[model samples]
Target: MNRVVVVGASAGGLSAAEALRRAGHEGTITLVGDEPQTPYDRPPLSKQLLGGDWEPDRLALRSGPDLDALALELRLGVPATALDPAARSVTLADGVRLEYDALVVATGVRARRLPGTDGVAGVHTLRTLQDALALRARLRAGRRLVVVGGGFLGTEVAAVARGLGVEVTLVEPAPVPLAPAIGEQAGRFLTRLHQENGVRVRVETAVGEVLSAEGAVTGVRLTDASVLPADEVLVAIGCVPNTEWLADSGLTVRDGLFCDEYCGAAPGVYGVGDVARWYNPLFGTDMRVEHRTNASEQAMAVARTLVGPGERRPFAPVPYFWSDQYGTRFQAYGHLRGHDEARVLDSDFAGRRLLVAYRTGDRIAGVLAAGVAPRPLRALRALVAARTPWEAALADPNAG
Candidate 1:
């Protein structure tokens, strides 16, 4: 392979570029992205960036010298329009076509906007640096805010807004927020955490419509016919994989770019980050993870397969993710769903240091905990990965 083309400029894409050089692939490298600016970290966008503690430069994933040293032909601020696997070429929006020996698609995802919310002032979704900056401007003290959806993004945004002294009302249609990811018990705990932090938690409720007047958001009408007035509204339903550009690309795409265990989308084309959905033999499912760790790990894996000589190991990862909300850090590993049993390890609910272990049949399936030490977290992750017996994991003192 003499030339490599990496689409997307976020964490996964940039990491792939660096990984290529590390693997001794001294060939023409092109890093393309739709965003105008250089690659930057996104996790902090919802936390410190919105909290006003971190500057824009702190989010820089790579310095100019660092990027220049890689000799990457950067095509920023423009998106890829189409892909031709037969020709091994990518078409950009400007009609320019670039051929490559290997292609890495890391386009990631975009925040899903709610219906009847577009073109309305004071309505927002945080996905990019620009989105964060715009939303941060409205996270003022004494302002009334309504955050729709109770997923991580919505919950985190509500947490930040509450810390900023903004009166926040978080609405979720589900019985509990984050129930799909962390289980109903943990979800209810998170709901209570938000309430204790002065955020009005509305569960089993949906946003019927976004009430607006004079082209600005006025409030939100709930499914129960109750209205919560708001100065600004944040739509945090979730995100959609950015794979529309690959519609006719001949690669299988279902919600995300479908790839094999080696992250191979086609013969020479690969996928990574949020846009890639690959089967995980470990988890027994095909997952498209949007976490930062997955992006970084998968990018390196794909790069090695493209440049480094080796037997291609399947990309089977023990899924992990963390969230920081209102001074509490919540972390989880493994698949929390399909577990038949959940057992508590530590029972200090008042101190907010709680730990829970999930079991599928006799084997441990997952772990969810807050305010726990790294030692226990690591042990839990190991146990889940190894599919350790439930009794052995429960008896491990460090697991608490």
Candidate 2:
């Protein structure tokens, strides 16, 4: 492969480019991104960046010297408008066509915006750097904020707003926040975590409409017709894949671009990050993970496959993610959904530390730990990857 193109400039695409160079592939590598700025870490956009603890330059994933060393041809601030797999080329927004002998499709997802909030002022969604900067400015003291949805993003935003002394009300239609991902018990635990930090938690409630006054958002009307006044609102329901450009590209794209266990989309083409739904033989299922760890892992695997002949490896990862909020760090590993049982491994009341294990049949399916030091939890990843018995996982901690 003498010419390669890596689309998208986020974690997955950037990792793919770097991995190719590291693998000693002497190819002309081109990295295309929609953002004007250099690749940056996104998880901080909701925490450190939005909380005003970090500056824009601090989020950069690569410095000028770093990119110069890689010698990657960068096409920033221009989005890919269309893809032609048969022609082995991609069309940019400005009508420039980039041909590639191999391609890495890492065009990740975008934030799902709420209806009727597009043109309205005082409404925000935190997906990009600009969004975070604007939101941080509005999170002044004495401001009342309403956050729609109770997912990690919304919950994190609410936590940061409260820390800024902004009165925050987090509304979720589900009885407990993050119940779908972390189970009801753990979700309820997080709900209390936020409430204890001075955030108003409204469970089993949904927003019917955004209430605006004189072309600016004043509040939101609940399903029960009650209104919660707010100086600003953040809609963080979820994200959708940026896969529209691949319409006629002949790649299987439903919720995301479909890939095999090796992250292969088609011949000389691959997918990674939130935009790729790949199968995992270990779990006997297909999943699309948006976490940063999965993105880097998948990209590296794909890059190696592209660089070396017959060096392909299946992308089987022990799913892991971490979130920091209100001075507490929440970490989890493995698949949590469809588990048959859940058990608390450790609960240190004085230390505010808690650990829980999830099991599917006799095998441990997942593990979640809050306020628990990562030094101890690192062992849980290997345990989950090995499909160890839940009893063994519970006992291993005590042995340590």
Candidate 3:
């Protein structure tokens, strides 16, 4: 392709752009994003970014010198209003048009906003650096923080807020924080952890409305007619794909832009990051992973596919993700779906290290653990590539 356009990128688009430039693609490459800032590591937004490290070097995905070297055309802070696959161009919100021979849609997902809380001030969602910056300023001692969801973002924000000595209350409709991802057995582990940390975690709680006065939030009203006081309420319930613009682009969008095994959306179009729902043969599921790793992996693969046929491998990488909370670093490798069993080979919640192995009917499917044990992620790609059996992984001391 002589000209390539990439849109809606957070984690993967940056890598895909670099990989394209690195692979000697001597063509006009345009990277477009709605967010003003360059792509940085989002996993840090809730962690270190909240801790107040907003330096350019730390948050910048591509440095000025690199951008100068590549001279890649960038249309930052401009959102694509419409995409036309037939016309081979995109219409920007500013009414400008961008034409390309190939298009990589990397628009990542956005945090879903609560309906009743639209007018509620001090209520926020953490997705971009600006969100983290604003939230960080609000996290001070004596501030009553009502976290509206017990998902990863909410839990992480709660952890950080509590560390800053803020009063944190977490509300979740589910019984535990991560019941949707991990089973009840593992979710209880977090419930106890939150409680032990002096965080008030409310389960089976439904928010009917958010109370506000003077154009600012004050508290939340539960469906049970109880009103909880809060200085700020953060909604981390869920995320929606940034694919609403592609509704007319003719690409299949189911929750996210659905793609084939190679992250290919259409003939000359593809998607990466949180926006792409690619089929995973290993899990036998169509996964739309919002993790940082998926963005980078799928983007690199897509970039290669656009470049040449150097290697034709299905876009299947061992799914891995990590989160740090309450001083413990949680990591996971492989798809933890339909796991017949999960055995705790080792655990020291107090020591901040634990190992949990997931098996799919006698075959090891995934592993979640704490600490810097990288073996699971290192060999996981090969294992998934080869469809390796779990007997050998279970026999290995590090994995089991």
lDDT of 1: 0.90
Q: Give the per-residue lDDT of model 3 (tens digit) for 31-118.
A: 8989877667788888888866454359777778877777678889999989999889999889999999998998888898988666
In candidate 3, position 89 carries an lDDT of 95
Residue lDDT tens for model 2, 1-400: 8999999999999999999999998879999999998889999999999988899999999899998999999999999999898899999999999999999999999999988788899999989999999989888999999999899999999999999999999999988899888887778788888888899989888999999988999999999888999899999899999999999888899899999999888988899899999998777678899899999999999988988859777888888888988888888899887888767777764476778788888888888998877676777777888888878877785412
| Root-mean-square deviation of candidate 1 | 1.3
TM-score for candidate 2, please give it. Answer: 0.96
Candidate 1 C-alpha lDDT tens digits along 1-400: 9999999999999999999999898999999999999999999999999999998999999999999899999999989999999999999998899999999999999999988788999999889999999999888999999999999999999999999999999999898898877777788788888998899999898999999999999999999999999999999998999999998877899999999999998988989899999998786778888899999999999998887647578899987888999799988898776778777777565788878889878888889889888898899999999878899988887788
Return the top candidate by TM-score. 1
After superposition, candidate 2 runs with Cα above 4 Å error: 391-400
Give Cα-based local distance difference scores for all models: 0.90, 0.89, 0.81
Q: Which scores greater on TM-score, model 1 or model 2?
A: 1
Clashing pairs in 3: 8-106, 8-107
